[model samples]
Target: MYRTILVPLDGSGNANKALDIAAHLARANHARLYLLHVPVITEKNDDSLVTSPSQNDAAMQLIQTALETIDVSDLDTSILVRKGTPAEVIEREAHRLDADAIIMGYKGLGRTSNEKGGSVSAAVNHRAACRVVTVR
Candidate 1:
């Protein structure tokens, strides 16, 4: 029933798995796929610096990389890159895109949850405006 699916990636294996799932779903349902990658931003000393590239620059590169990595030849796909907390950014973008569902990876770096879904996935499942499918 999903017309537009949002898939958040972090360049991790788990995220790639989610991408594959989203791609298949999009192909099956003839839906549009929105790929999002939230850059890893970290504070240095007292200044809040994006550990990744500058916002605009990093976003462009992230979108390019995401497109290159995903197999979207059979489905319509768009890329979005935003800077912020992963869960917050994903939720905001999903709403902004008016997506019908969000498909994302489960585990993340430094995650401690014994459950299949990681912190970000859990957060998105709780806060997103649409249905959240956390691929493990």
Candidate 2:
């Protein structure tokens, strides 16, 4: 029933778990997958800036690793790097892409590696225009 699926990832194992599920669903329904990574804004000594993948290896690796970890080789997949609050960007991309569904990790790397953004997923689940699947 899904034609286009958006999968937002945080480069965490839990996110990859969602990717695995999304990939399987894409294969079954012949759907296209859009992978999105939203980098949290970071601050330097005197300035604050949203990270760009071109300037941040961590952001680039997040995209690369997400691709490497998922088995979407046979499906149409596009990788997107966005800078904003994770929930907002994901919801925007979902609307812009006209996604039929969003599959994401139930928890992801929040402010740090030790915490999770249960709040972010909850927000997306409530706000997204499409169905949202939160994988644990």
Worst lDDT run of 10 residues, candidate 2, spans 109-118
Top candidate (TM-score)? 2
In candidate 1 the C-alpha lDDT for residue 48 amounts to: 50
RMSD of each: 4.0, 3.5
Each prediction's number of clashing residue pairs: 0, 0
How accurate locally is residue 75 in candidate 1, as Cα lDDT from 0 to 100?
84
What digit string (tens of lDDT, one per residue) describes model 1 on residues 18-83? Answer: 888888889889999998877666566456545545756766675567668776977888777676
The candidate maximizing lDDT is: 2
Taken over the whole model, the C-alpha lDDT of each candidate is: 0.78, 0.83
User: Per-residue CA lDDT of candidate 2, range 36-122, in tens?
Assistant: 887776654345445654536677688787777666889999988787677888999999999999999888877532125347788
Q: What ranges in model 1 sit over 4 Å off?
A: 44-69, 110-118
- C-alpha lDDT (0 to 100) for residue 105 of candidate 2: 88
- Could you estimate the TM-score for every candidate? 0.78, 0.85
Candidate 1, number of clashes: 0
Residue clash pairs of candidate 2: none
